[model samples]
Target: MPHDDVTTPSVTTEQNNQEVLDVFGKHRDLASLPVTENDMPIGLINRAIFMSQMSKPYHRELYNRKSCIAFMDKEPLVVDAAMSIEALTFKAVEYGEKALADGFIIARDGRFLGIGHGLQLMRVVADMQAEKNRQIMHSIDYASTIQRSMLRPSREALARTLDDAGLVWEPRDVVGGDFYHFAAFEDGWFAALADCTGHGVPGAFLTLISSSILTQAIEQRGPRDPGALLMAVNRGIKQMLGQLDGNDETPGSNDGMDAAFFWFDNASRRLAFAGAKSALFVLQPGDEEGEIVDGERMGVGYVDTDLDFTWQNRFVQTQPGSVVFVTTDGLIDQIGGPKEIAFGKRRIRETIRGSRHASAARINEAVLDQYRAWQGHHRRRDDLTFFCFRVQ
Candidate 1:
């Protein structure tokens, strides 16, 4: 009778190999080998190597007659548990074709506790990378949530300033450079759409900077005059970048925002809107006719624009049920659906017009649905955002 070891699982090494094969079977980069107490590996076996060996008479004889110990290679590569992935991979690669075997064994006090397989070791490293990304994402989410709270309420929140009101926001990455906020200032609700210079990390930083300035300006002054708020924000951002003194040629690059803002007065049923670089779309009541305010673009410090960068204020007096759409560049920039085409502004206009009667939430959903359909097999390259509301 043979004495059984309690520490070891009852399953045989071959069974363990089979189980490993079943799970990581598709990983061509992996391989397994038998180990010996002498610190030498007997026969080197990979999926390819084993298949070839099985077909040969000489190799079978070699395998059957010799104690796996007889074929042991004197010097086996081993590593500690704390070895960096770079070192582990380098060591694995050092074995050349034999590197596919179980990864470096983790030993403590001169005893083997466990083994790290190639795929699993790589996964461990990947998990660390994923965790870091999650932390970054959480930070961004927090910042955006805080900024959103500072936004003014929608015009519909008061009287019937707009027939309907809603906001649409989608981030390309975990965080986006485009953002929108709503606030009830003097008489009506004030809203804004901001597109910073970049997206993701760089753009997110600029947006925070711009958002803070905007909030402070609003709190200190008021949203009565949209142009004044923007100008103050522009100057604040310039000052932060030390470019407010007119020395455009500096060591670092310029940081600025392209934005549009509107103030809807519920009392007098008047609407005041101003834009830096963003455009506006309005759907008139009881008519299929649409209006596109080709209003001039606005620029902050360090950014250049030729299309009437001056801030122009526009007004519209209306009854209930008028829909207005404002958006950042993200939604229109989505790449590829059928033939990998951009979801251009034209497509957006049609979608909005078609869903004009839908609720704010439904309209938002419809726009995203159109975008997704257009981006069939393609992925979202940038953040997708839009604001839809009807004057009540």
Candidate 2:
């Protein structure tokens, strides 16, 4: 809201009508002039009104010798020097046409400071707003870099764990709420997908917090128990967001996440899956339609959600040459196609059914192609993440 004080010069009460007219002739740029007496604002004079009256036949002869106060407008717009531009804009509007014609008086504690113009106020406000917008964009860009840094290390781990895999992570905005994770444990590897509440900056903040808590949970509890990690994440988010008191009636208590977690054990050849209003899929070799693993009906960290509840894990034994898939709801929730309905899970199921034996990478390509074709020109609904890995 900072702005420059654009005040013009003023006139003294001692100036006679003729002297005031002479001042106008000398300075053609001033559309209005403020009159002061004892360094306090007394009145104002509109250039057009004064000039028109003075130019009339015999009018100057009568009023030129009169005191300038006789020709001055008794009431005028007066503004404080320290007034904010936003408040001044409203003041300008309330004053109507006189603000543009005679302008306003800039005063400090009822004493004449200077003269202010409406046009100058507008210019200063515009410049300040532009600068503020620039600063916000710069901060968002920096945050985007930090969010991306969280992804690089996870990719390195995925390379070591899988023979073939594919990942697609797209944020509707430059920084988004959707996030994914992958890491190698001593026995096997773990992966997860989460859709935090909202999108853009707010969502990005949750992703950072969610990702960090997930890493800490994996480190402490190990990746073999995905349900425990989910429980830990639920607790961590509730604690971080100050929603742990379990008061669902709070006005802004709905902030939380929908997530799916997966753990693949090498020695046991089993996959452990846990979810909070999310799901994962397992497609075995030569199978057109695979198993759909539905998760718990409850979501994580939400108001009214049980604080002491444990997420149940569903275990599936791995099949050689099979592919496992997990995704955030962004893709399935997208509104597109001729009917303008959601690109539902059935479409996803069909896309993978056609290439059940292929590596996760090839299957990803096929899905992407169909998704693009179905999406057409529709705007993205939310942040998106889709990840798949071939079981070796």
Candidate 3:
């Protein structure tokens, strides 16, 4: 509650001691009365102290007739009316034990408002903190449910779609910016991994928009050509976000995504890939090191409408035992290790070579284990996602 609601008696500095005593007599519960000048508090007079002074021999005779200011404490605890209960409690503690016992005065615009009890402020702050924590926990639980709904795919459907596959997805928060999508097309199969502009709730919202655009692009244009599919999705994202006319001088919404898309052909044993500032790694059978299929350097949304922003597709002929891996930059960009450096693309390549003969699931686990070992006790810097598939 605001201090205005707890107003108590106030006296002027010119008022005599008897007048202040009369105020205490009328209101038996009053502990302290503020002595004011021009509506501003100048001091405070405690009832017990005043009564003790009066009980002394000739104390009343020596000073009863003088102004109450003589008996008032010149330095008193004062706070603003607009101050929050939590802040007031902190201020009360800073004034030490004696000031807290006497209570503190509240003022607004240099005028007296009321007095607040330190104990009362503590109780209110405790109750508010409890309620706030409860509300936050409830909201996080709801968000986790929604995020799972968007991310998880059926196990049977996943098995039917690929000969062997592994996936690792870890969000920096309960809800995150990184997400993946997969669908079976008439000609082949399409899969995509994306990292939206930010993290947590804001980034999670962009993932929804990007996912919707991607699904629409695949349904309308089909996923036969990876480059064309990405181009169409980029246009759709720009139009949906109203960034078609964006430029360097007056750019449209700066929010967009970095994504990698893959189309696998069952009949030809071929993989077609396109990306927006993302990359794909291929480890062919008998090769000691994996190779990177670099995607387009530009990201999806901030490109100028007048410029030709065409994405190019890269195709690789896969053998029966070839492995293809796609991942967001989160893994390579994470900061940790003895040198406190990024995990880097070099480490990723080495991990793939080391786990070349393992099953897809084992390979995924191995990579994750290496990443965790590199990070040690450091907190994750961003969301992490990886997708791997072995050709039949």
* Models sorted by lDDT, best on top: 2, 3, 1
Error of 2 at 178 (Å): 2.0
Per-residue lDDT of 1-392 in model 2, one digit per residue for the tens?
Answer: 32235645567778788988888888898788789999999899988888888889998889887878876888887888788888988888898978756678888898987777777777877898999989999999999999999887887778777888999888999899988899887788889889999999999998899899999998899887888999999888887777867445455756788999988888877899999988888887766679899899888887667777789999888777778888888889888899999999999988888877677888888887888888899987889889988777
User: Weakest 10 consecutive residues, lDDT, candidate 2?
Assistant: 1-10
94-174 in candidate 1: lDDT tens per residue?
Answer: 765344343444444444444456666556667877998899879878866654553434323433343456666666765
Tens digit of lDDT per residue, candidate 3, span 28-129? 987788889999988889879988887799978888778999879888998888887777777778888856677788888889878776566767877898
lDDT values, one for every candidate: 0.65, 0.85, 0.82
Against the true structure, candidate 1 reaches a TM-score of 0.64
lDDT of 3 at 165: 94
Cα-based lDDT at residue 19, candidate 2: 88
Model 3: which residue pairs collide?
A: none
| Model 2 residue 325 CA deviation in Å | 2.2
Question: What overall lDDT, based on C-alpha atoms, would model 1 receive against the true structure?
Answer: 0.65
Estimated TM-score for each candidate: 0.64, 0.82, 0.77
Question: Which sections of candidate 1 miss by over 4 Å?
Answer: 1-127, 130-163, 242-252, 301-309, 317-319, 357-361
